[model samples]
Target: MRDPRMSAIGKGLRRRGRLMVQAVSPPRRVAPERRALNAVPAQRDPRQEAPGATPAPRAPRLVDSPVFVLSSVRSGSTLLRVLLNSHSRIRAPHEMHLRTVHVRFSRDFTADAMKELRLDRQELEHVLWDRILDLELRHSGKDVIVDKTPANTLIFRRLERCWPNARYLILLRHPGAVVTSLTDRRDNPDHAAICDEVLEYAEKLEEARQHLDHAHVITYEDLTADPERVTRGLCEYLGVPWESGMLDYGSHDHGRFRPKLGDWSSTIKSGRIQAARGADASLELPPRLLELAKAWGYPVD
Candidate 1:
């Protein structure tokens, strides 16, 4: 038999010879260019972003000399829209709730929410209102756009901020008439709710009155009583020449109904501009609303 010691010595020699061969051979080395290419890039501060990186999105193009009609709901805003749209120079579309749109973007105008969403209040307003009014102007082929959203009375200050040069046409109606009209449109009439709305409308109208330079108040009663005279005066306020066609709103094609807007404007869809007579003769005004109605030049005996 072979010597066990000799077998062990032979195995050790083979292991040593393999080690020597590996050591003598050149160690595997990455190419210099490959090493440079494979090296990790240096970290960059986000604040010091690379030049020519994507720029922040720009705000939308705003309208020139934009006109807005402000009022509470059921205050003849739809009539105002049709009358204004009838003018050759002005294009007034259906109620575009721009304030509500702004609220949707900013979520109650919270600074933290706006910051997180990467939007500024004025920027959001510009983007939304611009897109809407611009589209309306294009469609109507009119020089200037008039937005007749009654609820805009609530956000008149915000609108001023968005368009410092904007002109406002504020429509005022008797609180009883407004409340009665609103109640009629509802499936269930909630007196307390209607009272609250009347109070809110009064408050907003008062707020709007504070800015008399930009705002022109017209009573719904007067508008219905004298559409020509009232609309002509409105044209003067807007710095536009009055056209006779404005009185004939039924002749033109006002667009389809926008159900997104409240139901108070159902009559305007007929494209007619007849005055509503005795519409509010039946509503008994609450004392609080009666007091407000008197303050707003409404006969509330």
Candidate 2:
């Protein structure tokens, strides 16, 4: 009984199986994986070995010379940067926060202590160094490259470890007023945290004074009220001649000056400060903070 339907079904089944077999078969056989492909072996660069094993070291960084203005957030650091940059011989960038960068490279940091948050150390350092060089080139490489990162106020020792010869400028403001400025932020989740940071900065500065010899402390009030006196002192400290323009900082074109406090550029553009009114006022400080501030020779009142 040769059923025509049965015949067709058998033929279809055979065809399907053959196609399945073909699909399962391996494509063309590839030559045994090359030894080089089997593993990633180190390959020496021919050019590198031909003469000098290493490319001539990058032209030494534009200059190893780094000048840092260390202070706390909301402490008139931006104003300091603008005033210093007004000097034709100096390029002071808005806060680069080098201390925040340095601490991440270190392991001895106490998470519970006063040191503020850390940044990506290697990347931040590289970016900052590049920017410093760019500023140097722009200014014909004459003046110093100053970085006014407030976080650096707490981490000066760490920075000196990374750049042993770096110069430091310590800027201090009254703690009570600094806390008041921080508390104005009604929406900030970490406003209290900021207040703590201000306290931490005061503590670290005390620790810093014991080890830092090349640093000169500049009170924010002094710099704002009597810039001539403080700036002259700074120039003398740096061995730079006092420039008249430094005294008349308000007239300088700071259109390009970047304020680290975000868009608060107008706050500093006027170059007028209210800190001076209380500069000589004797305000109560936490007993500990008071001791530290006074140790730095801050006016007790």
Q: Judged by TM-score, which candidate is best? A: 1
Relative to the true structure, candidate 1 reaches a TM of: 0.69
Candidate 2, residues 41-85, lDDT tens digits: the string is 233233323653322212234456578776766677777777777
lDDT of 1 by residue, 1-301 (tens): 9999999999999999999888764645643312321333333233224466443344546575688887877788878887887888888877776755532331344644655666544465567777788887887887888887766777788677667678888788887777777677666577676767777877788778766565788988898888889988998988899998988888876676665453335577666665764446666666777776777776666
Off by more than 4 A, model 1: 1-61, 102-122, 262-266, 277-284
lDDT score at residue 97, model 2, on the 0-100 scale: 42
Best by lDDT: 1
| lDDT agreement with native, every candidate | 0.71, 0.61
Write down the TM-score of every candidate. Answer: 0.69, 0.62
Give lDDT: candidate 1, residue 299: 69
Cα RMSD of all models vs. native, in order, equals: 21.2, 18.0
